[model samples]
Target: MLSDTGYPGAVGSDTYDLIDRQLVHALQLAPRAAFSRLAAVLGVSDQTVARRYGRLRGAGAVRVLGLTDPERLGEARWQLRVRCAPDSAGAVAAALARREDTVWVSLNSGGTEISCTTRTPPERADHSLLLQHLPRTPSVLSVAAHCVLHTFFGGAQSLVAKSGALSAEQVAALAPDGPETAGSDSPVPELDATDRRLLGVLAVDGRAPLAELAAACGKSESTVRRRLEELTSSGALYFDLDVDWRIFGLRSHTCLWLNVVPSELAAAGEALAAHPEVAYACATTGPSNLHAVVITRGARELYTYLTTRVAALSGVQHVETAPTIRTVKGPGPLPLPSPRDI
Candidate 1:
């Protein structure tokens, strides 16, 4: 266990249990909802909810982050699978994670493979800087880049929400009001400098207060609110709930590459997305068109899921599994320097 003065440890003993799982689901439903409101929804006292939230946050088990929609910004998102020498895999993966361009990074294939996602502006999508650097590194054995074509489910959704703790009605009640239709008519709306600044702050902490956002963006509270609403309406910005999977006894983290019949691709992707173990699923352009991430309690649970849930899907021709040994970087905002530093 980490001392109180130090950073939260990976998994505190017994910090996660049935009630903790329920609370995580509640937060997943409403990432920035008020404690009292969440308390009412979960049928617990406000203090209980607050205390649990504090514990989870202090343990570094859960985090709420705001992310910009790359598609909305006309940026191309790429998934890179890189194989490296066993001894140098950690160095390679860490190097990729340290770049501001990469967001999600995982070390898989018994620590010999690294997988990550990065975005490139429209004009430079063909030649991302990270892509250029990897090939020149002697440690990298091979690399395959897949352009994400479509997401059946998973940017804003959380794996914790799939635990079935809350009913549909409860989730609907807790969900924040979505933006009204306004700027979505255009497929791509350009973001100005102030919009970028606003997004930079939001990315770090989605629940930042209006006053702080106003001060950072040099705008009035009302203006900041209106801009935020407009950004959401246009699909330019959204929030994601992230968690340390270890806390939930889900130690097995694996990525699946699936080749499904063309006609049944959508059906297959949707079915996988609905599984409680799945955290991410998307269609991409590569040898395997569909990619998914699953976390489970252990190898046995993973086997059950693959044999029963996954194998049951029709039209799945082949599946490849790469179990992640360590997470170089999990999902969230890019590791950019803080706004103050900038």
Candidate 2:
């Protein structure tokens, strides 16, 4: 079992040092890699790698889980901002987190703002979690939903890219071959029963053992391996690393909603993607055509980023910032149930 030295607490930079950061980057490459393999790749002992990962996991600083492509599952991903009365924001956010469909539930802007990402199925569109529930609650002041159109960059790969710990060669070695085709606009073939069962286990742990996964799906090891590869290549599934940035010296996370001229939306997104501090930036379908998540050491740093960095961008007319008070659900998708269960 892993030691609980940093468990159930926020680990500062002193507790999770530079070596821990490298290990995190390694996990970004192979989320479920064996300690021996990670040790060899990272030039550390197997025990060291294992211990580090244990402490990080125990501290709630990092998590590795399998995630399904929403589009492949024919689900819509929505970015939502909810405003509630000061006394009831926590209750509302907690309520949202309890629902199976919600992810990344966060309290922001003191205690009155809640931001979250929700995956809604087509059948539940009219009766969505927030839509169906929030309106009935008197505490909820207003809610706005933005559809996630195109993801230029986010998730595990983007996290590692911002780390700058690995050299180009190391990155190349860690990168999976072929492009990310998940959530493609082109038609995706329907997933079969076996495919759904296989995805169920993977959603819990992306790097689950071949034999274990084969048993779960009632298939031979070789068959399961082939199917896993096929699913990845075909864009049916993908993996992401989930971790808190505070362990890496980034003590604050803030989301920036920007109103950029329509013509410059793409340009602004591309520019935000290049910044190391910008973890996620994409175009959405609201007045704030561009949405960005940024990490910094403190309020002062965040202020500088807003004034000097973000303001420098052309065509940016308005900017709204909300600092994350707490994260209730995930930095990545929660484990999805099997299709039948859904």
* Candidate with maximal lDDT: 1
Please give, for residues 119-143, the per-residue lDDT of candidate 2 as tens digits: 8876667645656777788799999
Give the lowest summed-lDDT range of ten residues in model 2: 1-10
Pairs clashing in candidate 2?
none
- The numbered model that scores best in TM-score is 1
Which parts of model 1 have CA positions greater than 4 angstroms off? Answer: 1-8, 178-189, 334-342
| Residue-level lDDT tens digits of model 1 in 14-88 | 657766777778777766678899889888899998898887765556666777877667778888899999999
Report lDDT (Cα) of residue 279, candidate 2: 82
Residue 127 deviation, candidate 1, in Å? 2.7
Q: TM-scores of the models, in the given order?
A: 0.89, 0.87
lDDT of 2: 0.75
